[model samples]
Target: MRCVANTGRMSRGECSSIRAASDVGTAVELGAVVSQWVGRVVPHEGYMLAAVDPVTGVGCFLAREHGYSQAAARRLIVGDRSDGDHPYPFDRRARQSRVGVFNTDAPGLRRNEAMRDVMLDQGVGSELRIALAHAGTMWGGLVLLRPRGARPFSADESVQAQRLARDIVAAMRRYAAAAPPEPSGLALPPGVLVIGTGGGAIAAERVVAATPSAREWLDELGTRPADALTTSDPPVESIVWILTQTVRTTDKPAMTRVPTKRGWIVLNAQPLTGGTDVAVTVQPAVGTDLLPAMAFWHGLTPKERAVVEQVLEGLAAKQIARRLEMSPHTLNDHFKSIYRKLGVSAREELIARLLR
Candidate 1:
């Protein structure tokens, strides 16, 4: 895709911050950089950089604001069920066969089908979107939203945002290739792997233990665990092969973001310059841990996790009850819910399962 150069907004370091960031760091850096440009000196609602998987229409939220949860954001922005038709920005310029900025308030979007699906229906009164396109396909984009009745993105602001989007696209590709988010290699196994041509198992890395089938997911795209992923399964890889493929058609470093129940998972890949291997780093797009991920898969709510933390702390039932300000019966109910959700019958088993 074409990423035009611009000036006077993002600092050089901020533009290059993704180079040093982890997968999540890429998202954070994108958010911070764009905010610096848009916010000027003040913070706004927030922004998002999502990597789209064209085939499935599901990518992960690389970076977002505190007000927007990754899961919900994924559902709204890149989810197939949400806006499978009538994409923004790209569609606005589709007739001209170009990729550019799309503003919800512009005449270009007056009757746009995707606008309702993307912004109007989602409580976003106004938005500015820029698409990263290559080979007539959209790989990823930046979406800035405003609350209903808030001022819509001005024409000047939209132009600036679009220009910034283009400039960052090329820089992002370079940073991803030069220094991917992977650890030294899969020998260290950091929930990511690299595959060879023809989709064969070139390397298998250690994913989170409970997420046993992450290896197979790495084996081939669109494949899931052999067993049905119950509530306990980590959200399937929100793998993004779109932009990586777009930017590195023949040779380049590329990355993508996949959504999970707890957060986004970034899949960064680069062809090893000297070897046939393409290093792919699989990691969270945000700071997260096993407990929260596991809890999410098992359908454990925050309150349940709270109870679990107290239990893990060796708090007696009486103490736990007092702390939560609930009666003993209510505490027992939570215990029962936790046990059922976690598939355990006793406290010892619960602790063992959790620890394991």
Candidate 2:
């Protein structure tokens, strides 16, 4: 990854502005507040703030966009997914530099297979990508886009974005610790969503078919009108397409847990017709799917989560300490912190909260 020298600093007023935005609370409110602030500082035509999955590096869970058409956003996300296959993927680049620039005319664009074509097609000249990570865990990402003929994002502006990232991501982490969404009332069984490509000079993609229950999940997710399915109108459709691409490339099932307003739903995709098409199944997320996210929601540090895992296995404190290569005193301290953060007083309480 290339490193940018710190050529400038943000003013105290600008720093305070970001702090205020972080304090606004909730993912939606944070996006609205921070997007406006970023536009003022960076001069972008479109903005996206998303809460991404730390493990998968996918941002379909919770996202808010402004000033971008549905079609454009869908294409951009689909293109970004293919970028994941690059030798130097977005997550690694983001880890190296919290803020980075993407230019359509750069020589590196050719190395990026999918993003280049999408950027060219969309007439996007430049993009500023900010990784919303805290203490080595990625909470989400922010993207600012400029159209063709616009000036490329400058090094100084990138420095400003880097400065703003810490506060913004810290707020997003707090938002992640909030309660999970409620359960969807509909008790329908798991359903299928089929995806395939049409014959064209450029293989246009479409939703080939979907089960009734799958359609219910789409409606529950608030996807665009039925006409939009062929073109992949909503963000959810972008996620489905991304999973399809993954299944085709790896010849293995691809899966993700999507958090909707009602609750989390598991989406699993498998290749069909020798990878010519992909079938995605939608169902309620189970305990395994919810456990990792549960630790995140309670703001458990990685080490603390390790301790919780041992507890779930019914290990004694001394046994867990020995297994984790920590002293009993240190283990006790971790327990105290976990209990305080989770608002639990005992091991049984902790288990109940986690299982629930």
Candidate 3:
């Protein structure tokens, strides 16, 4: 029950958090902080702070202005970006330190009809966006939208937003790091699922590969594809909670995160294609440094990964060769290549790098 007092001149859109659990308390707090910060800075309709992972091409909004609808907010959080060329102002143009402003009536935008259409379709009169970037990576950005009939943002307001962009990026960065690495050994289909209005499974499908993190999430829900529409579980209850809150009109509850001993499992539910059932996506919050991520980065082949995994187990060359069904000489070749590509000197360094 943290209180978000007014921070600046604009003193509107302040609301109390109804989420009781602390599983996502830090992120919720970050949202409250950013939302309040935006409110204080300008007298706009709403603002959203988004965290984007350029490596994964996944983006999330930690805080969204209160006036947005749950359906719209959910789409923004977990929907497809290929809908059209929208007003994603914080793009490569702002990859450095530039702040972006998108206004429907701006004369400069008369030539870019696509941009104008996006703004009109969104029913927004103006917007402010800033991309959070570091070391050539675009982590994410912030966007403030003013609805139709509202006045366009003044230059000072844009400057004020620019000043806060870096701090907001840092805030999202800390929020992402707070989730411990995914620490479970359960398996399930990819990150997608379909839930009924009552929070029971309707039909589930895979959008990502199954991993221990996904399995543990299903275990938490006490659910599976077979249980679709059959019964409700604790996890289903939580999903139902979010659904109910979303329907409350005032609460902009778009997503929920479950805290675990090792890390965080996030659940994103949206209305399915037919609008009768909700689709839920499950994912781990922190696991970017794991084997697959490292292997891809280090350009390791399947054989290299197998050999490295064996080496990390303290197996000697003879045993590793026998187990891999390769001769001792052949095993030595892989070790040499692995060492060279990974910039490691010996098996010890290889294991150290992998474990890290």
Candidate 4:
């Protein structure tokens, strides 16, 4: 018995050691991934990695080797824009720099340096900014800095940084999928299950088409349309609400709402899944009201309305294409027309104007 107990203890120690080593390995892998783009920029003396909360318009520093601390980064990126009650201009210039599009040659970096002093009391060296945009919002960003006397980012470096920015965004998406849903007030994790007669088929087809992985689980279900509808965990409420309210529809496609702990869970059910398949989209019922803007935005042409609605809901061009059965290039054209008519340079401005 003693011998067996000793052996078990040894096995447990080895298991713990292996787990620790695995964690260290993962950290190294993440570092290597970032390192791949270092020289592609301006000799990369240091870098800042940050994640943005789309809903709150907040940026959180995930990692940084630059002089700025997390608090400093957040304050600088999401600082007050009011300028003492005089309304700030709505142009792209008004928006503070978060991560992408930083240039050593431009005035933006000079402004950032001034703000850095007020917020953090530190000055950043020459740097290149790159942002990770997903689901229509800038979710993460990277800032690669060079010490004094280092070369500014060249055109080639900027292009390489953009490519690296894309990888960072992809990594964040994977992280979000793997991370467990945080605690919520609801009994179940918020999710929408679509159900309807012909509606269910249409909705299911749309969902499966939009999310390829959904097909794997949906394929195992019965073929009967009604059988599929019957299998929905939650009964349908309002079709218009589910379609328009939950999943913000664009002329091209519909997008899933940003997941939240306290929000509505929408599900759609219809006989056919050919059209829009979003059965449910979760939205906050209490504090924020997006319906007024959504109504106005949806009043535009199906295509125009779709683009506007997705913008209001905070989805990016890539996500819109997936939901709408169109290419990103096509969606960009639609956005150009939408912006022209609305007289807005960016989606954020359009949303802010409509919501007001």
Q: What lDDT does each candidate get?
A: 0.48, 0.64, 0.51, 0.40
Top-lDDT structure, candidate number? 2
TM-scores for the candidates: 0.42, 0.72, 0.48, 0.36
What's the distance in Å from true for residue 319, model 4?
28
Q: Please state the error at residue 314 of candidate 3 in Å.
A: 6.7
RMSD for each model, in Å, please?
19.1, 5.7, 12.0, 21.0
**Candidate 3 local accuracy as lDDT?**
0.51
* Candidate structures ordered by lDDT, highest first: 2, 3, 1, 4
Q: How many backbone clashes does candidate 3 have?
A: 1
* lDDT score at residue 298, model 2, on the 0-100 scale: 58
Expressed as tens digits, the lDDT of each residue in 221-307 for candidate 2 is 443356454453322365566567667667888776555544566678887765577788877765556556656645777889899
TM-score of candidate 2 against the unseen true structure: 0.72
Question: lDDT tens string, model 3, 88-182?
Answer: 43333345544656677853223155445545666877766666665455666766677767777667777776665555655555455444333
Output the TM-score of candidate 1.
0.42
- Which scores better on TM-score, 2 or 3? 2
Compared to the true structure, candidate 3 yields what TM-score?
Answer: 0.48
Q: Candidate 1 on 100-213: residue-level lDDT in tens?
A: 333454443543454345555556656556675543444456666666666666666665665455444444343232332211222223454443434322111111223343
Global CA lDDT computed for model 2: 0.64
Location of the lowest summed lDDT over 10 successive residues in candidate 1 = 200-209
The better candidate by TM-score, 1 or 3, is 3
- Highest TM-score among the candidates is held by which one? 2
